[model samples]
Target: MPTPTPSPDELLVFTGSYTPDTGGNGAGLAAVRFAPKTGSLTDEPRVSPVPVSGASFLAAHPSLDVIYSTNESDTGAVSAVVRQDEEVLSPLGAPVSSGGANPCHLTVHPDGHWLLTANYGSDTMPGSVAVHRLDTDGRICELTDVAVHEGTGPVAGRQESSHAHQVLVTPDGRFVLATDLGADAVFTYRLDTGTGRLQRIAVNRTRPGSGPRHLAFAPDGAYAWSADELSSTLTCHRYDPDTGTLAEVSRVPATTVPDVANQPGGIVASPCGRFVWVTNRGADTVAAFRVTGTSLQPIGEVPSGGIWPRGLALVAGHLLVANQHSGTLAVLRVLPTGALSRPAPAAHVPSVVCTLAL
Candidate 1:
């Protein structure tokens, strides 16, 4: 059922949450409007106050209208926004300091001159990836390099150390993947863009409890996709894009529901990269895969119109989902064979996890 109206190609979403001083109830940064022939998101949404406390995650600036976030707390920050027009988004200076602690994912370096972050380190600290140097007008011009990230796994109270969540940036920009939910690992780096430094190269392990949280790159850059989040699996890599390295091959079961209590919480890839979608968060569901020819073809799992589906975004051929603990904002309808239809809501966003379309 298409045509719910609104679409001159209308699409602009930047929602990221967990803001009421971090107990979450997000009212800090939000603004939705996507409508690709009504795939949904505009019944009016915009909780934005633009304060930036725990702005969970967002990144956009391939050529600058700018917008970057991840100010996740316990003392972590990073911001740079701009787009004060079709519904405001201000703030472009006054956020720095994210060299460590909870910065949960970020990326922007397709020559926009580096801004990567993925701190997630608390519980006595370990994970880190900082590096930020961007000023052609995109703001943020300091924090030049951190890179910590030791190790630990087997998942006790969530792997005990090195928790770096996500920080990918490899669509041929020459590698900088980070994901390390307490070290099930996936650390290839090498972005010394004249000194913002990263330079790790390759670690890529996966499988002993597999907490690897988010890392999806398959636009034809050969293949890569992981959302392992503490064993609610889905691995399948082989990518090498001129030696950034991944090579795991296959794993599956990102929530087909058997013993329940899953956790994948987000993984996306489909700009016709032949499909991949995952978001299991305790099995609230949203799975679907089919990268065939290099493995992965489970295409099954549904229901994620709400509840815990952290975030998954694929715009313009739908599949928006950001259901954090059921605070809505679903969309799902990308089935011309990639399969995923059966999500509906489109806005209710209370503590919505993350989504960025621009």
Candidate 2:
């Protein structure tokens, strides 16, 4: 008997891009449909109805028809949009200040009560994480709390000040973790859901000059992994959900050519929690690894099918890469052995930095 082919899933993907004012030619948030069977994307993307600037990152509400994005500007801001249908998005309200400079990443609380932003400060500014309240309509209503971090790594130019690159809530939804590239640390906090305040809990330090960028937790929430942007390395840790403590287990290169100028962009663990993947920007590749009880064994690496892959998402058994410099989205089929095939170009969206599938 032969295996039956699975029917394709119709996926609505939203892409975030750098705007003209940010040194790129992006019109703003763009939408495209993806066909899983053919590994193809809609020929043209539908631009957002309203103008948005520096929408470098986006996050979808866990259970609502709404999307949130970081403005990624000197005066940071975050915006919300309501999904009118499968194809259209309507602005929910005016953009709200993110309470810091150059806000880069944002995420919605698992309970859908709060929105969080990680601001990557410039030379003159300090990095901070801000929280906002989400209204019944899924719109951002007001600022709730802001936690500012102070520290620096050993790196000379890149670690001059604190730069929080990403904020992630634990799978149990009890704690929030922020990655600071400039500080070489992952700061842990307990979120006060009622007040939106963050209580500092723990600080997990990585190797000096590692420049921890982003992290993904295991499906069971027992482990966590981080992609180091500066040293081009990956670090694994045992995560204690109850205490919000991350204990380091191991560190390994994100790419085979470690001496090269490879910068890891995004890191994700497989849905089954058996595999982990990281995107290498300078090398333009995706590295795969086998996860074994909080330890990592390098699997292999494959071409990203474009230049400067910055963000990646796993959708419907496929891996999608947002190639920032090449202005293209690439799709790779995830094999049964937990490896990714060479990607095929899907769509062209200029200066794309983030991909969110809903």
Candidate 3:
């Protein structure tokens, strides 16, 4: 077997089920020092706390001293936490509620001065995106603004109203993209860094039944990829950085799994922008794709080797998967050909799995 790239000194994981009502707090977040080059983990992994109701989505600040997570509640909130050390992370303070409901995803500004959240809720009440200012110490302050969305989807039962699932910022800090599952559209917002404001720029519809969930931009910033959970498809868009607009270039099936019930979960591009991967929870696999311009061609599917793979992260050159149902983090070696292999048994956690990073 070919030797693996050297692993980072430590890895930290955050699970979603930390709540006082559930007999816990951030205590479910765990950390371990690992040697990926040798495929070995620490004798005893260290665990930490991430304060939030449901750690559904996580984002690390570009500068790496802070992390943000969506609380994902019926009455939802977002928590900003400071990374104190290798095995320590504590909440900066109380989580700021998303000001709508069921807040699901979040992203930090490139300047690290603001954070945005997507609140996914029912139509009777509607959903919204909230913007907050982050101070130097990583504590969130200044509840500046909220943008409510309208319109319903084609699926009557599933799309009665707005359900904004993710909020993403362009690498240059010029724009923010919010994906609405209910509306099946990606809304662009022009960001004002000084005032921490979001101005609606454009709304691009995905496939009618697509139910856009999450998005990731290519490293080069030439294209953006959106994962449609309901339609099981991926759409590529040509991103205009100067204007902060998205133009759909192509649409392709997100997975080759024969099971039609499988739902797409996470969408992420390789740090190098050469490959894209999407998780299929019910199919228990990860779909790999090669990118050319704004088009994506499926490479293949690899068994995630666990149940309900909800999240994917890259740490020290290894692809780590948080298998929600299996309660274990599966580690895969990304081959040069863009393939992933069954992991050799290493770090394991029980109950729920959410994120893995170093």
Best by lDDT: 2
Q: List the residue pairs that clash in candidate 1.
A: 211-230, 307-326, 308-325
Candidates 1 and 3 compared by lDDT, better number: 1
| Prediction 3 TM-score vs. true | 0.89
The order of the candidates by lDDT, greatest first, is 2, 1, 3
Write the residue-wise lDDT of candidate 2 on 1-358 in tens digits: 0111122366677888888988788767887778888888874655453456899899988778888999999988999988776556788899999999999999999888899999999889878999999987789978988899888988899999999999989888789999999998999999898999889998888888999999998998988899999988899888887788888889888999555789999888898989999999998999889987667888888988789999989988888898899988889888888888887765888888888877
lDDT of each: 0.81, 0.86, 0.74
lDDT of 1 by residue, 251-312 (tens): 87887788888888788888778878888887788988888877788878798887888888
Clashes of 2: 0
User: Which regions in candidate 3 have their CA more than 4 angstroms from the true location?
Assistant: 1-9, 13-28, 39-43, 350-353
Which structure is stronger by TM-score: 2 or 3?
A: 2
For model 2, give the 10-residue run with minimal summed lDDT.
Answer: 1-10
lDDT tens string, model 3, 263-336?
A: 78887899888888888888888888988767888888887758887777766666777777676667777788
Give residue 183's error in model 3 in angstroms: 0.4
| Clashing residue pairs for model 2 | none
TM-scores, each model vs. reference: 0.34, 0.95, 0.89
